[model samples]
Target: MKVSVVTLLQESNVENFNSGLEVLKKQTLGFDNMELIVIDQAESKSEEQIIELAQLAKKANVRVQHDNSLKVEELRGKYISFFDFNYSTSPHLYKNLCQEMDKHSVDFVSANLITSIREDRNLAGAEEVIGAGVHAMTGLKLINKESLLKMAGENKIELSDSFIELLNVNFYLRPFTFNYVNKQFYRNKFTFNESYVNNSISHIRYIAEHVDLSASKKSVSLMKVQLLKHLTFLLDKNMFTDNLSEEEQAAAYDVLRNFLGLVSKKEIQSNDLDGYTPLFNMVNKKLDEEATHYIKLLRSKRHWYEQTNKYKQYFEKNPYDLEESLSWKLTKPLRLFNKWSIEVKQWFYKVFLLTLAAIWKPLTFNRKIWLVGEREDQAEDNGYFFFKHCRENYPKEKVYYIISKDSPHLYKVKKLGNVIYHSSLKHQLYMLVADTYISAWTFDECSYPAPKEKFIKMFGKQLAKKFTICLQHGVIIHNISPYLHKDRYNQNLIISSSEYEKKIIQNTLGYSDQEVAVTGLARFDNLHELSVKKQILIMPTWRRHLFKINKSNFLKSDYYKA
Candidate 1:
């Protein structure tokens, strides 16, 4: 065969496979000289899907195989390309690119990919899709199968399992000819939320660390431009957002640090960064004049309720290390006074109100009471699911859901019996006496009327033995040990949907096997009886950088547009 078109498939993109198949079936270069290799990567391939895929393959006169059973050396094609399940290509795309590949004898060939095309711009000759593999859309590019395998052999990469990684790594491998077709033949057919900012930062670091200094001047300039452009994009679009967590802020700093170190060896022109200066003096033990002045200015502008975007312009060009200010030092006494005031009030609540509620301790002792909540103001998530299950199935059991009295969801939750107002007297009583407290959010968000630390401080050792369950809102697919760690959340039990997730909880969160259960989420039970819908449901997960933006800014974001 002259060409091998490999398609990546998973449960998420399986629906789009047939359309991609149609694009290939109508190829200007006939199927007699081409072979389609379908690699199914989905976890549990259904018999129906398998049969349907077989039928499609038979109709198209192509080959279909699971990723596990396929061998790279067995591939009959001379040149290899990829098929992005959600993208459509021109009928002659493969033929056109292959002709150029053959004529030029280039190792890689690509076209101008459309839809969210960031790397296509002229970035000082480096913009020809070299170290930006993560951003470069698949299916628009092709590589010589023999050369790819040869590179894999030299690099010790297993092409069958790590084909994608090999391809990404190949982008940085120098002395390989690359050809780019200016025609926009490949177009994305769908839009999805990308962890672009974080991914770009990672890719930039990778290229910066691995790029060859002995390469052409144009290549070195390209590397510099790529780094600067990616950093600038992130600074303008994400770094200035209102809702940056402390950890995320630190991560941003790390990226900046890496970029500074990478470019420090060479003299980068001021124009190369588009007038954005890198804060290279931040690592110095003593503050510089400019940094000191900036810190003082920021301190004077700081207020109790300062708007998030008020000092954005100051940070537009470069982010400085000004997290701590002189005002913070001066406010220590005032902060301690405020803390004392709050403690006194809490002491009063614990002494008087808690004493009053303690009278009903005997009543709660005889019965097992489960206090559940989601968002303080809403009845959703796994906590609500479990609460609903208990209320509906075991009417005699005591299960109380908490929602704020002023919340719009209060009326809806009230329809379900045994509901209590959030932070109310009754809520506090229940929190103190309940056998178990459960939430999809933090314990403070549901169980405690105030912060959990205050509750701990007020109750002391009395609340230590209380059982709390973390009915996680979603499946933990990535490492979030910082949030879920036992030292941070300190729940008795955590509900996990899969064994893989249970292991992550145990291994990363430092939970014992007994403490973490693979019981799955209670919400999954509700999913069993759901009516089938002839529609698509797209529930994109939240990104850390975009978490705290206001509605206006959110609506204007590229994430919202996508």
Candidate 2:
């Protein structure tokens, strides 16, 4: 069978490619008849780089071609595989994979081995947390061509649904059915094994099994209220508690839930909006019909205080003009419409026109919008919506991210079509360029930006009415102060995972009830139990004030009580 291998090549440096090519030559174990397609992963269009690739393919005795031919859909076939050049493969990796392909009916296939790197060490599939870029699927695999054409044509490079679930939780590979060559083979995360010996493995595994690859069976994660409904059922009904590993399933969430109860035991005192992002996210999550009634009352009073005393006083004489400056201050309601004055009437006319333009925004999807990526490495894995869901959901709009220079995704981000990368954008530049926007509480877990600046920039005095959504990423444990501090601006949507969090976010961020939802991260499904006998760990994270597990025996007196 002919295998089509598509890999991005990385040379330590192109003009000096001898050493890297030497490594590839020695990789093949002297095999033949394989077709190799190389896409230069470098940004430079240097002559020497192209030459080096051609020469290396010749020495390996494999057919080589440069691919810039068509879009992803235009490229298709059975038995196709991809990876960057830095990936290493064992002598029989692909051959064994080929033999295994002969054994099962599948769509696409990847390596049994995934590694997390920190410095020189390989953290072999330890917990295999989903988002780190350090993974290199074994460079060898035989894929089913029909599946390749199917997924590629649809522009889905990875799973169809549950992409967020994949990111937020740890997964394990399926055994035998997965056919691993050795124990503890790792997948991607920039981890260094540090002191682990050759055979040591994390007690947990990721992705214990592969579900149906067909699109019909995909798209299975739930909204927040739905997940909570299910979770409440599971815990209240004692459904999985009978299983031997049931303790592990509850280890991540239980401790956090209890710890919050413990912390609440203390007095409610005011402090400068400290590390409260997670706390607010949790409270925001609890903002349902029941929770909203009480929370809205508190938010109303806070709003009155801010408006009567804070916001009106603060931005009254500011250089920039807006209906209201964003702050933990009073809000200006759109309902106070006095359109009779010629000036007010003109602004109303402009607002009327902008609303019409918004109705047809789809035609201008190519216009760029901000996809607020977390700048910290730890939070980078928080499941970027642009790459999976956002881009997929709004396929027409161009997405841009302003991330820190050290972000691992800089190169990969460029590869994603219509995505622009920026860093340290000036306030002026941000006002001029950004359209719709999304943001999180910072790595420092403080407040989100008051979005009106974006509105004023995009729509002038008439805020662009951009559809902004602020969803929390992890198990939240801090309080509802800084993020909800009377100094932040309210957003269009203050998304959370629980009703309690919804209340906190609305009270803190000052967005109203219409602004929030508890849609669970589409990624949280990892915590769920599949229909089959799959022994996997879908461990979501917890904030410091939430919970910490033993990492070994999850239930050993430290799981929930701690």
Candidate 3:
């Protein structure tokens, strides 16, 4: 079987590249069975320089690709091996790995790596075993191209070490065969680099996201132990102080903050490997003494709701006694007032909406209606999409937009001549004049009440004469509440994405097939038409109760980071 050896060359380190190429040429598997593919990732290299490198590879009977692209789409090999230019493999490594694989049906194999720290290669470091061949990167094994491609899907192979490790971890999590060889099959050149700290912490996040912490508890625990050891080693060697510049130190501090947040997870918190506790205690002691200023800074930036040792003790003893704690006791009156104000305001708004309905009953249904989203958010969702379409299609008809005073889109909304912009305070007047009322969220108080700013006194019953529509935010993933189907206030129309969603809305909102429209989400109409970029935006919702009770802890959480 043919084995493809792939190496990515990023820097202009010709000496290291030649060393790795020489080792590949000496593989015992023979040139006929093994093919080398070198990917040139050095963007600074010109066409002439790249051609020279390609010529050198060609002379060694190895294929060369000069593009920086990592999409290994058309690779020709039964098994693919990834290697680094700074690493050298044993001559018999592939031959032995193939022999071992034949004895057992395995998907991947890895061996211990001998690391040399000195330039002379005289002083050798201990052999490092990188987990059960799953977390292995430098000394990684050969796997079938089909299997690797199947797992990778459309995700491009990123140059980031953390991203590459995440891909490997994902592959290992699949129910596939994996093995570890005791022999050292590769030699890695160890060098001190400040960037390694960032890469290491990033890998920790990848492990947390992809690994099933419940099933692989031991693995995660060991990783945490190893990470702590690695950090201590870096600190002892003065890697953070001597090597990193001022800007680098600030960047490293940000990474450290993120790492601390990851370690605070429930699964990671429960595990404490042997020797880790002593190291942590020592570090804490050192930080308390030498890093007093840094500790003070951290405390200043921390949230008010974050519990301290004293607060924890108070919580354990007092439990339900809010008056027992100084902080809680001081805030109790304000909290009570806030609670009372919300109920009283909601009551007043309900009555006001009913009064508006009385005035609206005698007025004619104005074909020119208005639409707005929940709160002072942007005009990007279903409501905005539908509003834009209506204004463009029927220019003669009046389409009003009730924008929140604090909305960032206020300026943009004002520029649209076809659409009239009004503040939320004038919503009751618009409700009286408009024939239709459209919103992304539920308008009825029994379902989803309007925010304090957008409160229109009218309930569902009062707007019975108008064409009321609830252009829902998104498809429902969970079971819909039975209260929605009752439609106590009377929503005349409900929009759904598909027949499946329509059925769910029908069952939950008690709306028949005729009442629900399957016109697809209007917001997604021009999504494909817009220019896309190679960037990802993650929008995560916050827990309301958690923010209210433990705002400090919520601010420090990964959800807030996302």
lDDT of each: 0.66, 0.41, 0.58
Which candidate wins on TM-score? 1
Alpha-carbon runs more than 4 Å astray in model 1: 10-15, 43-51, 54-72, 115-139, 154-173, 189-214, 217-221, 231-235, 238-256, 265-275, 278-562
**TM-score, model 2 to reference:** 0.27
Worst 10 residues of 2 by lDDT: 195-204
1-562: candidate 1 lDDT, tens digit per residue:
8888777676545667667667887878776778877767776556767786878578444776653454556667888776667668788887888898889997877766664354445422334554453345232667887766665443333223234533543454456667656664588665332333454455555555555566677656655655655565564442323333434434655666666665643444633542334234552322233432343344445442265555665577557545367887788889999999987887887887577657787766668888888888777678778888888899888889988888776766677689988777887778777778889876665557756676668775656667988999998876776887899879899999999999888888989999998888998998888998799878676566567554445667787888
Off by over 4 Å in 2: 10-24, 28-31, 44-50, 57-78, 114-141, 154-219, 222-562
* Span of ten consecutive residues with least summed lDDT in model 1: 283-292
Q: Rank the candidates by TM-score, best first.
A: 1, 3, 2
lDDT of 3 by residue, 1-562 (tens): 3787777776533437667667776878886677677777666665666676867676544667666455556566677777776777788888788776666657766555644121222211111222322234234666766667776654566544455565555544455565656564577653546555445545655554565344255545544444444443444334454444544444444444444444544433453323233333434344433342333333444434365666988888868765687999889999999999988986786677667755764653534555544434467777777767776787566676666556787766666543333434356555555667777765443112234234433344445566777887777644456534545736788888888888877776688888999889888897889997898877644344444322334555666766
Measured over all alpha carbons after superposition, the RMSD of each candidate to the real structure, in angstroms, is: 17.2, 27.4, 20.0
TM-score of each: 0.43, 0.27, 0.42
Across 411-464, the per-residue lDDT of candidate 2 in tens digits comes to: 555454444334232322443345655655431122122343433444554334
Q: Evaluated with lDDT, which candidate comes out highest?
A: 1
